[model samples]
Target: MKIGKVLIANRGEIALRIHRACQEMGIRTVAVHSTADAAAMHVRLADESVCIGPPPARESYLNVAAILSAAAITGADAIHPGYGFLSENANFAEMVEAHGFVFIGPRPEHIRMMGDKIAAKDAMRRLGVPLVPGSLGALASLEEARQVAAEVMYPVLIKAAAGGGGRGMKVAQDESGLEEAWRVARTEAKAAFGDDAVYLEKYLDRPRHIELQVLADTHGHVVHFGERDCSLQRRHQKLVEEAGSPVLDAAQRDALGAQVTRALKQLGYRNAGTLEFLWQDGQFAFIEMNTRLQVEHPVTEMVCGIDLVKEQLRVAAGERLGYGQSEIRFQGHAIECRITAENPDTFLPSPGRVTTYHAPGGLGVRVDSALYSGYAVPPHYDSLIAKLVVHGGTRAEAIARLRRSLAEMVVDGIETTLPLHLAIMEDPEFQAGDYTIHWLEQFVARRNPAR
Candidate 1:
């Protein structure tokens, strides 16, 4: 079951991150990329590289046939689909396994189960995970939606069953708005995901976005790496994340962790996964589960001192988790700032040459990026160019370190979110960790009233 070589089916920082982990584990890496990313850092550092297609992602990164062909050409024993792209694709996972390469993720059935939001919620409910009160499944009609909204009370959320990144989601302030919200949500869902199926959930007014990171092995051993507070987001896309949330004490962490691990074990889940929740009034309601590594996984690693990517590799190779939940411990606090190639104020994509690149360096600072001097930031992929991670003895210390690191870090010749992150670090509310899922949007509006 030893994985000698792995094919990285991704790009940018995450692809480089997986390559580094494979290198550390004495596994050779095959980096697959589009023609536009032939010069990417991961492609350059890999033992072998393959060009799958043109600049557009549809022709390249998501091209399953080309990626599988590359893996075959490179003799890869496994395929590691990093956080995005084909990571949560159940069909791709099945194809990878069908092609005789280990897919370093959850089983296809698990991915398929969680890919559908309604099915995932039902499964979690059966496994003792708390869910927000709403419709039992996709609403069959506007009347059904109205009934569910009334049952859950007004101010409900209409969400796409196959949606993420805030797409296909609308808020109905009251019964008067439910019809339009439902129509808009379904339309958006169909246009975006090719599926118009939408559901309802009781909207918690001031819930914090907290997620539990869990790793399960094929041997039935599961462990949790605590929780991350990702409430600092704009439009449902997280900008900053903190490990071991400020409001959650050790007791709270243990209780949630125990519940998550137990539930995942009962479901027979394997590999890396994250269970997202809305925490309000000292209670957690399961929202959804991401069946892949998260973008902010480094923060969890910093606090738990576990190499999640390596664990994924091991589990995919049919190895058992050597330790149990009790053995896993949370250490110092960690924070991660997702630095994207976008305007700080307008938040528009800024893809161009990176004339100068310098990442922060210190005892507890880590930069996961693929950017370099003279590199062209591709316009075809995700705007995220780098992730700045910092660890410290406490949340206060982590903020201080993050501020210092942000000052030292530099990405020139293109607009980046560095300024925005610096502003966040300086804000008192952010420093105090007195924020919720709606905090960032309000903060941004306050900063720029014109927008």
Candidate 2:
């Protein structure tokens, strides 16, 4: 494979992460930044930089033409979309290819199929992948949804087919809830993703949000690295993640991993992708596929000792995968806590300047962030400030290390979820890995007694 220049089409920590990988590969990098990220760490460290557009995302990171122009002007051969923005936008992927730049991810068709939740579920079902019982297609009317819910049984989950990041998701326990859920879900879906299409599924109560990380090349070779348990969450957002989910046994892991691998190979998947599953009562059901790298990727990387971003670059360059499933091995356990700028309880975006910043450092501790002392936390983008990842020989050790790391981490001048994370570490349910998706809600309730 010919190694050349690559363009990073995102900002902040992820952009820097890709840049570091490209640098290691001795490849030149072009960092595209919005007006808000002009002085970001990624922009300053890149081999070259381009101002894509203004502070807003639609006019900037999601602007296909501007990103293509940047790649063309910078002489970049590939464009790497780091996780969000237009990362999984099939239209943008096609545009990149049309402009003679390789997209460092799955093919355009895969993105389109997975971008729509309903379509992705259909594809999974076709490949014999386990999916929750619910409407096979979009519910055209409230009556239709009610009928499907009756068959699949409630409480059913109403999700925007074209939405992600927990933006357009709700629970409808019965027929009455289904009617109002459809309208509200569609409204939020259209506003967030410009697509109001939605689908319903049986919402498994107290399911662990486990996901398998898979890598594939154009050579038809695909393998699951491992699974990450992201059950500890708030409002459908993951707060803490760990590799080799304590919830799954060896036989269960192999079964779920093999199923996901078969589905990916059948679909001709390539590059880096994640198959999300809702695990409950020892049964795994496919939720969706993220056709881009994930935020919790570092946890898997830490355990597997692999540079996923570098592999993405290699695969996009038409190179075959370096390691097969048998060659990959999962070592010790690893955990990652997403330190974000938000109200501990309300979970509202709390962006502001970092009057003082201190990132924890020591053995077995890794901090992936773009924050620095006195740097302003721009309100123009996601609130994620840093990821505190730690590895240990055992799950208990990893938890202890994570607790210490979070305590040592300091980011002043903005209210963050640090306190909440601390509380989580101290929670007995969390310490024992006995919590589920709704654990945070229950924990908060206990933190504040009834008025």
Candidate 3:
């Protein structure tokens, strides 16, 4: 069940990352692209290229039929849906399997179960994972919502059953505000996810985002990489990420990792995935599970010294887990900064031609980017231009190395978040690791009063 030729069903740096992994494994790769991405870095490096559709993502990246057609024509035996696009779509995964191609991800049923927040919670609970105090299931009506809120106490978070990225989430302080919160959350959920099903949960005042990276194989073996601290984010979008959270003790980290991997192993899960948790008061609460490779996977890979993308390919080919949990080792602390094409002050997308794109070079520094000197940063896609990752023997050394690497990085002709990252690297609170998810927005407000 070896995968011979692989088709990449994504664009940009992730595709290039997967391409390099396949190259290293001596496997052929087929790059699928839209008209706008024909000149993308991944397209240039692939063994073969296929144009799926026009510029828009719906007609290109998300068009399952066209992607399958491209894979079929290219004779690719497997498809790697890199991070976004159709990566977590259960229908797309089933379609790929239906077309006789191995989907380089978890099973379709696993994807579907985790897609809904309610079902995912139940699954996690059954596996002995601690969850945030919330509704037993999705609320059906305003009355149900009220009942759950009463039982769970006040200051409950209304969340979309099928939502992520803070889109369909609201916090209600008391019963008086529950009705409006429910309505608003439902509307947002419908508009954003096409699913108006909402749930109730207890809201934590201050919580840090910690996620455990897990990998499984068809042979029933599972392994967990140490967690990543993604507390630095805006509107639920992660910016800077680091391995070895400053707050968690060694015992706590190992316990949480063991809990997550054991859960996945019990559920018959396979492939790469992430179990996100809210860390508060020395307790870990389950948030949600991401059934795809993460953008911050580089940080985990840097510290663990395992190529996650290659492991996905190998697992999809029905191979056994190459390395056991004891064989895996964490060498150093790693940090990653997502450098985006945006205004440093306003945080708005600034897409245009990259006049000068010079990546930094030094020890413990790695840059994953699709940008070139003349490559035009497309407005229709994510504004992330590159990811700067650094590793060191200690967290302090990692931070200092990341600062040096960020200082050396150069991207001209388009405004970028480079200035913002630079300021963060020098900030006292950030250096002290005393920030949470809400810290970035507050920092920006303080830096730019009257904005």
The candidate scoring highest on TM-score is 1
Report the lDDT of model 1 for residue 400: 95
CA error at residue 190 for candidate 1, angstroms: 0.5
Q: Which stretches of candidate 1 lie over 4 Å from their true place?
A: none
Off by over 4 Å in 2: 448-451
C-alpha TM-score for every candidate? 0.99, 0.97, 0.98
Q: How close is candidate 2 to the true structure, as a TM-score?
A: 0.97
- Ten consecutive residues with minimal summed lDDT in candidate 2? 442-451
Clashing pairs in 1: none
Residue 296, candidate 1: Cα error in Å is 0.4
lDDT (Cα, tens digit) per residue for candidate 1, span 318-411: 9999898888888899999999999999999999999999999998999999999999999998999999999999999999999999999989
Q: For candidate 2, write residues 224-333 as lDDT tens digits.
A: 88999998887777888999898877678778888888878989999999999898988888989999999999999999999999999889989998777889888899
If both were scored by TM-score, which would come out higher, candidate 2 or candidate 3?
Answer: 3
lDDT (Cα atoms) of all candidates against the true structure: 0.95, 0.89, 0.92
